[model samples]
Target: MKTKAVRMYGTDDLRLEEFELPQIKEDEILVKIMSDSICMSTYKLVKQGKKHKRAPQNMDTNPVIVGHECSGLIVEVGNKWKDHFRPGQKFSLQPALNYMGKLDSPGYSYEFCGGACTYCIMPNEVMELGCLLDYTGESFFEASLGEPMSCIIGGFHANYHTNKRNYDHAMGTKTDGNILIMGGCGPMGLGAVSYGLQFENKPKRIVVTDISDERIARAKEVISEETALERGIQLLYVNTAKMKDPISELMAITGGHGYDDVFVYVPVKEVAEMGDKLLAFDGCMNFFAGPSDSQFQAEINLYNCHYTSTHIMGTTGGNTDDLVEANQLSAKGAIEAAVMVTHIGGIDSIAEATKNLPSIPGGKKLTYTQFDMPLTAIGDFEELGKTDPLFQKLSESCKAHKGLWNGEAEKILFHHFGINPKEL
Candidate 1:
């Protein structure tokens, strides 16, 4: 079968083209993609191309599709998966297969599988490892977001405290302890905030710092302080760029004790060092951002690391278990996956939208594969509503849900602008 997809050939070369797909083998499954969310890592891959470690080499001969955050319906199930999976079942993927410790992953390593395409094949390893899961979420977007949410979950899991002997250790965040989230106003930061607040061992106080006041304001809109208050958790947003002494303010908020858990969401050296400095005694700092540069380095105090027991760590993606937890939490409304989405568009916009993702403001960008329209920011839906009737409908949907997109909005959009099923 022939399908359209966004393929990365080299640096500055992402092409939306038609290509033929081979028949699925007995050990594989074919899926019709419903929704795919653009990730910052995907943008980085576009810029780095063959230079990216996980990205396939020789793209000029065999270009790979470029997306991993996606959800879909099974159109054809392999004989090996027939007992567990069936045609018409909805599913999402956990792309970090870690097969034989290989760096292979969908969107980065595969030619026949990726989220951005109209259709994709799930290989035997994915099925055997339980990477493909049945999705019972309200919307396909929520399923697509499961991957990013899992990364945040994995970060929280990686955080730990060590005793003086270093023999005794505790994993996960400190319960009822003060926490700091640097660069916490972005989409992934919002996810960390939402998940952190609703965590089983929740923090007593959470301080989110960002350089942009506008982002801080948007963060408030996405994960409201009122909700945090209702949960009996203190939530504070700070614009450190405008502060004369932001570190002093942060220290004062924590009563000079610093933060128990500090999550750094930006890849910049300065931000990483800032997060490291905010760590309290026996505190854990999670460098949540993945740097584009291979040789990226940041200055950290070795004295504090040895004497104070403060440590730094980082993780790239989540495991299958983390994805399952993320899906469950989002399904139960414990985490607001909708808050992470700020833009929506059709498949035709994938190439340009991905090319300019880093420059674009706001959260995740979602695409409906079967539609044909320019990318539209959720914030501009009201303005677009003045001229376009469909956007007017979308505006109403978002307004009804407290300015956030939801399953209802997805239904309205698909009803009005989605392609007919018969056409596919």
Candidate 2:
């Protein structure tokens, strides 16, 4: 079978090309990728190329496709997995396949198995390690976003607080406790806000801080204060850039008690240090951002670490369990994965969209593998509609849903492109 995918040659080198795919073995599977959401991790991978730990070293010779947060339908299921998986089944996968203690993963290391493609092959290890997942969500974008949602979920689970009496550690954030998310306007940070609000052990209050008023305002509009209050949780959005004393103002929200759970979403030194200072006694801080620099360092107060029992930890990607939980929540409409997506493009736009992801303002850049369009933001759909009928339909659908992308918009896009989801 012939498949079109974006392949990496070296640092900052990616090309979209069509090639013939090798036949799937009895233990393998073939998938038709429908939707793939561009990740900042993919941008980092492009910057480092083979230098990245998860990327293959021989990329100059054997290029690998570059996308991981993806979802689609099973085109063919090999005999070995015929009983468990069948053709025409919608699916996604846990890309962080820590198999055999190796850093290798799909999108970074695989030649025939990645997300930014029309069709791809799934190697044996994917199913063997239980990373291949079946998705029954209404939108393929939701399934594609499940991977990132899992990472957020993992960060929450990785946080731990110790008990003074038994010296025991309690997993996850404290129930009915104050929570703070630094640099919380980004897609992942906003996702943390949504998840934190709907979490089983819901926090009493969540304070989201960011430097940009535009982003903070958008976050509030998407997940409104009324919405948070309906769930019995208090949500506050703060723009620290305007404050004369940001720390004092932030701490005042918690009555100077400080936050029980603090998550640093930006890799900036100041953000990390600020999160360290905001930690309450026995507070657990999670560094959720992946820094591009290998020697990235941040200062933490040892006094608080030793005396107050405050500590910090970092996590990369989520495990299979976290992925499963994310999928379940998204499938049930408990969380809005669409909030992460701000732009939509086709497979042709992935190379530029990924290479310049940081410069591209807004949230997730969602790509449809089979379409052919430039990277266009959901906000610009109405403007683009003046020149393009396709954008006009998209603008109508998005406007109907409060300027956010939804499944109806997705179906409209697919139909406009003459691609039938049922056929795929």
Candidate 3:
């Protein structure tokens, strides 16, 4: 089969090319990618090229497709797993397959098994590791979002609090405790906030901090304080840029008791240090951001670590269990995955979008693999609608959902673009 994909040749080298895909082996399955959410990890991979642990060398000759957080329909099932998976079934996968302790993974090391293409082959290791998941969600975008959400859930699960009695360590965040999300208004941060609010052991209070007023405002509008109140959780969004003393002001919100769990969403040294100061007694600070710099350093309070049990940890990709939990939570409507999406485009836009993802101001940049369109933000639809009727209809659909992307807008996009989902 021939597939069109954005392949990475080297550092800052990406090409939109059409190539023939090798026939799938009996242990491999073919998937027609429907939607893929661009991630910053892809940008890092592009910048590092072969230096990235998951990325392969010799990319000039053997390039790998970009994009990992993706969802689609099963086009052809290999005979080896025909009983477990069938054609036309919705699917998503945990990209961080630590199979046999190998660092290789789809979207980084695979030539034909990445999410950026119209169709890609799933190797046997994916199914063997049980990373291939059956998605029951109504929309493919939500399924695409499940991967990132799984990362957020994994961070929450990685947090640990210590018990003084037996010197035991407790897994997961402290239940019904004060939680602080530092730099929590961006795409992944918003997902963290939404998941924290809807999690089974929901925190009693959530304090979100961001330097950008615009992001804080948009986040509040999406997951309003009223909605959080209905769930019996106290939610607060603070623009640290406006505060005279951010530490004092944030501490006041927790009644000077400090936070039980603090998540640092930014990789900046200052943000990490700020999170360190905000931790309560036995507080667990999770550095959730992935920094591009290998020399990135942040100073922590070792005094508190030795005296008060304050600790810090960091996690990267989520495991299979976290991905399954993310799928279940999203399917049940407990978490609004749409909150992370702000822009949508087609497979043609992947190279540019993934290359400049950090500069783009918004949440997730969703791409429809079969379509050919420029990257457009949901908020810009109303303005772009003046000259284009397609944007006009999409603007109406998004406005109906409070300036957010939805499945209805997705269908409208496909229909207007003359790409039929049924045919894919």
Candidate 4:
């Protein structure tokens, strides 16, 4: 069956083109993708164009589907598929598979699963192994983010207790004390902070770092759900641009003993090592962001590991459990999906957004598959008539006298005051 997908011809040359999507077999189900967000890791992949290197610079022999985080309701199920799933029910996929569990999984070598795509024709062997599940009132976007979340949950469950690479012991009621989060401006980084801030037995402080001063300023003001400030939830917002020695400052803030857990949300090797320095004795450091290139590696002081018992671990391409926990966490208020998504656009804008994501100011820009126009306002704020503050700020930044992401030059003036989408 033919379906529309944002096919990538090469770097920054994505197209909204129609292609034949594979049909579901008796054990497979069909889902029309409703919403998908471009995660930062996927953003780097799209910009690199490593999917099919042999393909021409601006052309493709095969169409590439363009998202990994997505949500949709089931529309069709064959007889065999019907027993485990039903039509019209909300569902999100746990996209990767542990090949040892699945004979139908796409590869025989190292780990292999399709990258981010609008929709997937996943194999039944992966599903029956119990990675994907039905959504239970969690926000569809939250459900889409499950895979990433699962890794965080799985990280905690890992034999880190027995992991002797770094810290041999951990001290906390629940979490690894004080977490330093790099790249707090983006969705994945913020999600890690949210987990650190809200999860039971969490750290004493969450120091969020990003190069963009504007994004960090906003995060300091609006990035939490809890009431008490002393719940190990200190927001150490810093200006990385001004720092000649950021690691020293990070260490000073944590009392030189360092954080119990430092989550390196970006792929920069230096940042990962800095997190290692911020560790207390026998501390654990997590590499949450997958580097765009395979050659990316961080150099940690092995002596620290030998004497202090510091542990270094990295994770990528989330598992099935990530989605389930992410969904439940969102429902339980650990995550606020509405606030996390700052921009909404359609297919064409998604093409542009996919190209410009790393450089953009907002956290995440999502596209609704059913919509035609890009950048439609999802909230009830009436379009500003004469002038609006946000619009005014945006206009000065855009300097075109039209709305942000305008293709047809439709000048949409946003409101200075209005109802929020989350309030409803």
Query: lDDT: which is higher, 1 or 3?
Result: 3
Best by lDDT: 2
Ten-residue stretch with the least lDDT total in model 1: 415-424
Model 2 TM-score, all chains together: 0.99
- Higher-lDDT candidate of 3 and 4: 3
Task: Provide the lowest-lDDT 10-residue window in model 4.
Answer: 106-115
* CA lDDT scores, all candidates in order: 0.88, 0.92, 0.91, 0.58
Over the stretch 1-424, how does candidate 4's per-residue lDDT look in tens digits? Answer: 6566676655666777665666678876666565566666556646666453322333355445666566666767767877788877777766555556432222111111122333445456656767547887534556655655665555544414324566454432225466677776666666566566666665667777888887776565456424326564666777776788887887888788687666677778777777777777767777777776778877788998888877777666556666677788776766544435566565557677777777776666665554453553323122431355544444453334112222111123212223121220
- Once fitted onto the true fold, the runs of candidate 3 whose alpha carbons sit more than 4 angstroms away are none
Which portions of model 2 miss their true places by more than 4 Å? none
Ranking by TM-score: 2, 3, 1, 4
Clashes of each: 0, 0, 0, 16
Task: Summarize candidate 3's per-residue lDDT along 230-335 as a digit string, tens digits.
Answer: 9999999999989999999999998999999999998999999999998999999999999999999989999999999999999888988988999898888888
lDDT of 1 by residue, 1-424 (tens): 8888888888879898888889999999999888899999999988988888788788878988989999988988889889999887889899999898888888888888999889888899999889999998868889999999999999998888888765977889999999899999989999999999988778999999999888888888778888899999999999889889887888899999999999999988988888888889988999999888889999999999989999998888898889999999989988988888999998999999999998887889998886677888998999999999989989999988878889888888778865443233
Cα RMSD for candidate 4? 7.4
